[model samples]
Target: MTARVDSAPADSQAEAFKRLYPDQYYRRFLSQNTRPDGRSLTQTRPASVVLGVITSADSSALIKIGNTTVIAGVKLEVLMPKDPPDQGCLQVNVELTTLCSPEMRDNRPTEVPSFLTQQVDAAVRGSSAWQPQALCIQAGRAAWAVYLDLYVLCADGVLLDACVLAAMAALNALRLAPVDVTDAGNVVAAGNDAMTDGTSHPQQPYALSKQGTPLTLTCAVIDDRLIADPSSEEESLAATVVSTTVDGQGHVMGLQHAGGGVELSTAHLQQCITAAQDRHTDLFRVLSSAQPPDH
Candidate 1:
């Protein structure tokens, strides 16, 4: 009888190799205080933003960090809140399409999208990024609900940070048409006379306080080395990942930690916060310089 040999399944083989070698592979670069992509441990990738990408939306922006791309669109709707008669509402949704990554499926439910949406909601709400009252056209009668939809066109890593950036940029570019409150308590679009120009006029929209704008920075811990804005491969090999958000004035807005490998120290947490603060200036500059897309 001939001896029979069984080979490991392809999936299992890949997983086994990742389990065995990724740490060593990453460590070789970490020992030099650098990443395989030639970035220093605390370095972040280049980022860019383009505004007014979607003509249909009240406002839209696309942001890219490294190869990760995210687009955010804002749609304004009139609605009355039941309990909060005085304040308006902001609803945020995030979607990762299959075109971005094989891990995501078309129209399939996933926790990641929901989690990202909630994270962005909390970040904006927790900070003074937007005043809900500004969206309220009439107390208890009618108010503008801003719906922010974020789509991930590419996923290199740092999904949450990218989403938040896109949302902020889109909101900054928003220009709302003036509305008139009728005697019947109906919200109607203002006439062309509302604007000095006869052409499709743009009105000064509800704007977010620039000083209150929030920026998020993500750090990955590998072999006790803290790396900022890790790539997808680095994230997979990380022992723990921490995401921290800071406002323009350097106040911590939100902090989140994931992965099960390592326990983070208070000192390390402070380092992450400091790094996020340092990144705020550069991020704000990028957002400010972002030009509206040419028609």
Candidate 2:
């Protein structure tokens, strides 16, 4: 008589191998001071920004970091403020489409996207990047509400960093159109005649300051090696992930850490901050080159 046996499925076997031997698998590449993608420790992926991709939006930018791509659009709306409304309001929304990756679902708001939206909002608010008063048409009566919408076309990891950069670029490219209040107290777009009239508000268009914009840098810690801008595969193997936002003046605007694999020391944290500061110039150069010239 012959005995019948069942073996583990290929998918299950592969998953088990990764779960059991991830450290060892990653260590093989770390020993050579390289990553699976052939990038050295502390090396970041290539980044690029394109401005004015969406003509309908007041401002728009498309940013790509490695294979991850994020598009941000800014739209300005006039709103009547409630009591104690002294400053303009900023609203941010992030969408992670299933087309970007298999892990995401269609038309569903996932945890990652929600978390990224909050982080981008905090980064903007914490840095005081936009002067709310500048957006005010009339204190407590009327103000501009800025809506920033971010869409992830591809997610290869380092999502927060890409989103923040795209948002900053879009805001930098924004140009506010002149607005006028009618006799009936309704806000309307200033026509050519109104633009020439001295009675119209003499507000000049302005853009966000590049210096106040903050850039986020994400690092993945694997087997005691810190890798900058980790890929999706590397992120899966990471023991700790740290994201730090730095302004152009080298000030640390925000810091966040996730994962339970490793505890980072103060020195290690400082090292990450320094690395982020060092890369600020390169990112700023990309943003500057993509901005539209002022008319």
Best of the candidates, lDDT: 1
Give the residue spans of candidate 2 off by over 4 A.
1-23, 106-109, 192-200, 293-295
lDDT of 2 by residue, 1-295 (tens): 8987789899887668767897776787789898767889988988999998887888899999999999999998988767557677889999887788877755555688889999999988877566776677666677889999999999999999999999899888887767776666577777656543244465566565545679999998887778899988888888899999999889999898998847998887998899889777778888888857343
Which portions of model 1 miss their true places by more than 4 Å? 1-20, 106-109, 192-208, 293-295
Query: Number of the top candidate by TM-score?
Result: 2
Candidate 1 weakest ten by summed lDDT: 195-204
| Candidate 1 C-alpha lDDT tens digits along 20-81 | 89877678778888887898989999999999988999899999999999999999999886
Q: Residue 99 lDDT in model 2?
A: 84
Score candidate 1 by TM-score against the native: 0.86
> TM-score, each model?
0.86, 0.86
